[model samples]
Target: MSRKILRATYAPQPQGQLTMSEHRAAVKAVCVFPAGVYWGQSYGPRIVSGSNDGSLLIWDPETGVTNRIGQHEDLVNSVCIMPGARDRAPRIVSANRYHSVRVWCERTEGDWEWELVGQHKHFVLSVCVLPAADGEAPRIVSGTWDNKVLVWIKQLDGVWKSELVGIHEEDVRSVCVLPAAGSEAPRIVSASNDKTVRAWREQTEGVWESELVGIHEEDVHSVCVLLAAGSEAPRIISASNDKTVRAWRERGDDGWESELVGQHENLVRSVCVLPGAGGEAPRIVSGHDDHTVRVWRERGEDGWESELAGQHEHWINGVCVLPGAGGGVPRIVSGSEDKTVRVWREEAEGGWETGLARKHEDVVLSVCVLPAVGDGAPWIVSGHGDHSVRVWRERSESGWESMLVGQHEDVVSSVCVLPAADGEVPRIVSGTWDNKVLVWIKQLDRVWKSELVGIHEEDVRSVCVLPAAGSEAPRIVSASDEGMVLVWRAQSEGVWKSEVAGEHASRVSSVCVLPAVGDGAPRIISASNDETVRAWRERGDDGWESELVGQHESWVRSVCVLPGAGGEAPRIVSGSLDKTVRVWCEEQRKGWEEQICLQLDSSVSSLASYEHYILIAQGNQTVRVWLPDEDPEGQHMLWIKVPASPCDAIWNIDPQAGKLRKPEIIVGTSRGLATFTIEELPF
Candidate 1:
């Protein structure tokens, strides 16, 4: 009954069937929690931060504007800026839990885009960038849970060149690029779950050599490099689960010396070096699960002084220092699990202040302002990769809390809110990978409980509910990959019964129920991988009438019935893997008519009809809203693009009772869902 909901936001991928690179590039924002903050080497006046939400937040304190860049489907753990020496691009490289790495850039129009340039076999935990020089490209280094360190370079032809620099028996958790001044070549350093730190130096183009610096007794999480005051030898600093930040100094060829910089009460998550000036040793900032940000500065040569820089309500996952950018002295930024991104500034009194609080949480899949739920406000519901669903209440427009609801053991396949009869409370039904259809109901105690119905043998792929046929309650029809369709209904005696429709030769992918017409029983229409769309009707004199309504050259994956006119034959519209949508209508009840195929350019993934409009979801990741009878020349009315291809969609165009605000359209993909409102259509 307890539902887990992810609140991350995902923008739409473009409508042009995008290549993998283009698809990752167009994401307007991913939901990174902003745990890692990278300071300089970026453009002027910008601080970029990374979070588990799979996006980077670029905060310009001068303008109070936060721009989000890049999008990954999983957790984004690390971010680093490529030094702006490259004239073609001032870029940011990030690593994510998807075991992939990406480079983000800005266009002349000031919009952000990303390219999936590379990755590792397991979660990509950390990334660092070495600046470009001598007309050569920058080096991108990444550490991964895959137990490997990878170095990435770009050729002049815009092709990515990569090499495996080192291998560890345990996870590589953090990576850092040493300042170019002190190494034979640009040196890249990594921290690992194997309790060791490894440094890799580029020997020649596309080649590297590695050596061990020091080992931690526990997992190491982050690493950063500091250039000494008068020496070319670099110092490496690290944070680890050992609850300490340690600095390692270079010895001879591969020898190193370690010094404990500071200690924390909990596990340290991230570390960054503050650029040193005049006579001070460069300071180090460390964030930890103890919810505190600490500064470590040298008291004497071997002694260190630790000060409290900031405190957060939750774990401080990342910390960084921002250069003045032609304003003032440097400032420190921290990202936390309490849904806040804050900064620490030094006051005129030489004391530190950490009151720069900003909320940079996950994205909101918006719902319309409604009166039914959310404390008489609109409530937003979202699905997460954790296979949990969350409903955000409207206490303050962004307010939400976790509550008990039906849950899916895997990613939820489908969600439908059944319209209740006689003004009763609505019920929610969800289909999932567990191959069961679960119905959630709210009890008198205001708690939600789930009732499971094992109807499908394989994953339950789609579900739809029909207007009351001969009964008062809506009839539920579900489709599945098991090649069967199920119909659930309530009997007059208050008992529920189910029927199995086994007409499909392959997987039944989508289902739609016909609205009631002139007292005749509402029919159920289903589409299947067998390359046909079939209509089923309850025959008063027999069991059921099954008719093959539409045929295609390939699999029929989506189907929707146009709202009939006062009990007329349902006009069935379907989309297929054949790159076209075909309409099937009965001509005087004898035969079905086929219209000229509309060109989609890719496989059609879904279809939905509402209020003089038919929305065709094509594999190009666009939802094209078409008007059947209207034309200027001939094109869609509006096209909406989403980050992922929409697998299903619905229109809540009908106004609900109690003056509830209705979301005009809700689009669904395999990984995310989005909703938008259109109060007035051009039609």
Candidate 2:
């Protein structure tokens, strides 16, 4: 199936991340550097990240460009950029959970390649680059689950050799090298699962000695060093499973003391330091299991104040800062369990904002937001060209989650939610190109099951649930391309009986069940390619009959019934290929008469209504909301531009939920599904 990318930024929360498949792979590590540092092109700052899906990607945040550089055999645990001279091509070192560390570098021809540089007996959890001194090769330090830290130094012949640095009582969780001071040996800080942070200094040549720095109440998950400025010594920061981030500073004569920098509601997974400019205090950024990244800045006398930098739909695993270039504001990049590497930019007025990027594999054919089931969020149902039906629910943290509920033998053409019948559960009714209408319901075991309820001579084009009037069992109406409409009635023992309700001179295009008026029988409305809209009703023993409701200059593509304003007669709304919308109202003597006509720039593909608001999906890649009763001149019309041609749209509203709230519009396009709130549009 072809893949499509969608970006939504209508909500006030945060812009979304780069989303892949529904089974999202976790992003474990992220790092950022100057664009020209590793790649041949200069595109400002670039972000590189490793994911649990085994893929490594390089992203240019400014241009929204991405390149898959390499893949690993297992999930990558950590990543860091190799410090090198300006003339040398920088390499990215990544440690994976599969006991290996690899280096990725750009080739002479501008392509990318990777090679294994180090190996361990157990999975390596963290890796960092140590800058090379004069006449010496750069070294790489890695911490592993084997309870040891290993140093890999390149030899005179260009081969890398690994040696033991120090051992921890428990697994080493993270490691980082501090900035080298004048004539001082390199220092490395490692955090461990045993709740201790250790400081290792190169004694002579390659020999190293370790000393305990501090301890946390729980496992120390990550550690980093701030750059030393003026006369002050460098400070060490650590994130712990105890849900706190602490900074350790050296005392003149006494041992090191730790001060609480910030606290999270959940475990702090990773932490990094952004060196301050001039004499300002360095800012600390931490990622947490609560799916948030916070920036902590020292607010003299008030201690440290933290601002929410960004949020993920799942746990945040890693975070890094991209230094500002040419006086630009630094950007924060976060890797999340949601399988996305998000770029957060500082706004001019302070705070941060993100952009949305999502990918879907198949075209979405139809979408409908189900009636709110309970006090929780409402469920959204969609039909796809890949013969799959999916239901989406909003996650408590943020973002929407999807689940595959049903699979069909052919493309699902339409879908609608069916109200429950007596003690039966609510159902999802779908029509397919295979000439079948299937009813899906939640079984006692909580699994969804589908049953074939009706068959048509040709492809079923549309399906809608008939309004349940009084004690009558729930019914469904379906339209087919064979110029026929069928009604499926609920029978005893959960069985359904189908009967022909209407026939047209040409193929039927759409169908909608009208709301019951007073104590009258349920009515069905059908739009056909014969350029007419028809209403069907049962005349008791005379069976069902259809009569013309309105006509268009061209083939009618869609039809919807709108309740009369206040207590007036109901109205029929239709859209045609002739690029016009007409509203039909029942007159005392003239029967159904066209009361309002609107000319449009393009043909209307679909039509839906809630109250007096008419939603029109047009062929011109736009969706428009019209209030015909209030402003007929289109002064208050709201227009939305979509990336692709909109196929169908429906208002996500549930009156039974009580209390009025902002309604969202769910639109199915030839590419994917799009949803956004229709808040505060002028009536």
Candidate 3:
């Protein structure tokens, strides 16, 4: 007989009644940061990330290993990968609050080499690389706190040379290169805190001329070139702190005229164009402090209109739209201060939707929707504060609702709904601050029942359900603040369990069961504040042997097993307080080969995995869903923002179909019960 492997599906399960203890524990709030900034490769599958920690880390999107390239020695302000580098390894240029510019290179041996390339007399605010000139070395343009634009060019001798190009009368905030149509001598565009967009074109030989394109009364922060095929001229897009995005077109001679493209509810931070699909019209993607990424496309006859794309709970920082594979639809990737990266793709009918949210957890996150599944609408489930589990459901063509589930007595931390059970009601299990595990079930009469299992001596942190053993009832495992794994076995014919696994040293934070490993019995994996994940197997005569499989630098909060891809070896996913998620695979020589899968700018609290994506819930009350293979540039993923207070802890996330008879997101919050439905917003 062939063994069957079960893959986890996400949906909302009904919530049972809440206990007073659960309510009391749901007090602190989870907070999310800005949502727009995203990481992408201009050359390869590597991601360039700049952090408040004052370092620029280059990450391999495939392996998630990071190499610190440029050390700002202070808060690194911004980073950009240069375009059009063929022979040279990808170059990363970063600006710092310390008024310096650093360049980093990935050597042939894969190690990162860094150097302080240039120094600004004043704090450096932003940096960007231009499309290189034919046979000439690439140039990097930077904006300074002193309100100046400095251009650095690589000399023939392999040394970098710098020159003070054009000076903004006030602080320069961002610099971008707009490659001239059919020409290699690209033009430079700069935005300033002084409220202006300045355009510069390379004149005769080496001299550059500048002109004020559009004078915004408010500070301009970001700018990019929007390119389209068959067009003699490319449009320039600029975003400002004034909450508007404007487009500038060349008006005859060298002068440029500007028109207001659209307005945002909050400050605009970044903008980029989706590379055109051969004959398809070009689209523009914009990120804003409003925590949204709005995609605008030409309507063939009409100029341009906005498509919802998606919205985040925090401010948006950066966006990069990339051409898809094998003539597929184009994709847009964005990153934000909310600490995530999101990918979006266009449908056959030109409709835009979310792809996956990469679980990066960097601030300035952004999301793009992917194509909806067969007859199924895509939905987002988020766990937040307010002591409630909230779900957001998408309805009709343009409607959505938030639903609230009241169950936990205090802050609901994490939520996971078991896969649809055979001849059984779908169930949701939540870990909470009240040190108790609550199971929610819907009765045949359509009413919900919330039952408290035995209370944990400490906070119940995370939970997972094991696939039922042959003829055996399913079991639920809970991790607790006391560093222990409690396994509960079904007592009655229902999904409820009555027994405990009873093993550990400190608080067990996360638990997962591996898929059947050949004739071997299923194994349970648990991560703890003890900085280790222990794998346990049932031995003959009912005894068990538990061995430590992996170790971490700090508290391990979440654990998951990688679904088998036609392979028999076991692989597991674990997240830690050290802000990294690691994938552990067994090695013949070494006990285990641990590879970092994703790095978060902040601590990672919970994680869930789908066939092709991984969703990460953070300490900041934000969730990031990542696609590991879609973009070599690591530019594919989506970021979903949840509204939680800064200090609020996110316990769990369970994606399940609700007993309310609709797709729902059941999230545990620190305050009160909340539900987000595809039909209506939960108040």
Candidate 4:
């Protein structure tokens, strides 16, 4: 039997590395680069990291075991440990760029459970925890440029109370909590773009006061409070755009002593302190814009010496010293803009070993499901950011077996599995960013062959298979970024021919062939970036007529042909970047009428029609199912919040999980493809 294999681009290019190939091939490099990293006090010495790909990961440095704790809505900005009771599972709070803070804890099923506990008005930059006292519940402090410094207090009744600490006028870059000393409450220190490090203290009941401790010339990007080592009082270390790490000591009553501790080649972005070997002095580590993390060591009356602790190809965003097991030598963890997180553990002779991280090599651009045969389960075929397509066959109940089906010189963007006839193996088609369309044919003798067919002038964005007609050879439709839609028909088992169906004023994003009526010529519908949906009809062989069928307020991104109820003139549903899903129904001899319009929370990235319902993949991690009704308000739409990453591609999959087989929806995100079945798809 025949199968299609594809492997090309999988994710974005690494920041410090030129290509995904270079980054993954580097043996010493561990690939996991979550935007934020922290060590949980109760967990088993595992390092918790928040990734831009919307995952919270736990890394076991000693054993090289990486566990995905949970996921975030968007790019995760900060992660802080939440103090739980001794018997309760460890809880962690993570802040994402999507303006939300979420809390996660371990579930009984060995996975994780999380809830959206709070939201900010703008991008949340930093988060820190206030250690709980004897009678008071714990509290969390977070800061951002958009709104006030929010203090979320966990009350005894289990409801979270948010208090706004309005002080910083500009962007709050970092926040650190100084534990309450004696009778004073815990102090919140924040570094900001307003050029100063300010401390907020609650003097009276529920009232807070701000005090400026030190000022920097440029934006202060990071702040950390060094644990007082007896003789030396509490000191605040700040990193900034000025390329320096300075320490501010508390002088007599609110007075401050400024000392430049170390210098970096570029602006310093993050700072952390590691315990010295055998309880000696501490080592201060700072990450810089020069793509280096420097370690500083002081020699009493002599000058301080700095060594390059870690190196990357891009600017570093976060750095933390994962407290070692049983107070051993600490390991340094650094996250970089290069899409990599490197772990450095102090080895023999003051050297560090940088090595245990792997992220998705590249983004998956499109996915399609191949149905299971009599004895097998369904297989998921995917096109990636690179020039490759992969087939993931369900091996067991939840396990998958992956096969690289095909490859292109550039990014592969789309994949479609064609229905097979009788005992014939399946055939698949793929589109790429390199303006090439390829069809893979599975022979009866069990060999898979791929041949490049239609060639466009620009990147191919979408592809679909035309349902087979009696005499029509197997045909495939492909849309390109250059506004042209090409129809390809197999000339033979080894060759294919293409013809332009029609054109859009702007780049075409999606194309679908309407259901065939008896033996009539197939009607084609396409959604364009120009905010219009156009329909094409093939008159004879070379004659193709086109007309504007529908238009949206913004760029149209997705479209699907919806069969009318009771054999009515078929209708079309279109979704666009304007955050609206519109249905266009045929109006007798007149043009298509805009029937139903439903506003969504974000841009509709993809859409699929199942039975009588339409599924929409929203740009912001949401999938909504719209059911047809006489109500114009579209109140019957059922929606589900897709977990974590942006849903870029979606499809309806037939699952063989049990005897009662039903259609389930699978969504593709930057993290991976997830299958979530809707029990109540109102058809």
Per TM-score, the best of the predicted structures is 1
Candidate 2: misplaced stretches above 4 Å? 1-23, 37-40, 108-110, 277-279, 355-683
- Among all windows of 10 consecutive residues in model 1, the one with the lowest summed lDDT is 17-26
Each model's lDDT: 0.66, 0.79, 0.61, 0.71
> How would you encode candidate 3's per-residue C-alpha lDDT over 431-549 as one tens digit per residue?
77677777666567645577765577876767677777787756677878777677776676444554446567777877878877678788788998788888877775675678778
Task: Tell me the lDDT of model 2 at 341.
Answer: 72
Candidate 3 residue spans exceeding 4 A from truth: 1-46, 55-71, 83-86, 108-110, 156-158, 182-184, 204-206, 349-353, 357-683
Question: Which 10 consecutive positions of candidate 3 have the poorest summed lDDT?
Answer: 25-34
Better of 3 and 4 by TM-score: 4
lDDT tens digits by residue: candidate 1, 363-406: 22111121243335434444332345455443334433434354
Q: Estimate each model's TM-score.
A: 0.61, 0.52, 0.47, 0.58
Instruction: Report the C-alpha lDDT of model 4 over 339-438, residue by residue, as the tens digit.
Output: 5566777777767767434433345667777767776666777776546677775543545556777677776778887777765557678898678988
Alpha-carbon shift of residue 136 in model 2 (angstroms): 2.7
Error of 4 at 15 (Å): 19
Supply the global lDDT for candidate 3. Answer: 0.61
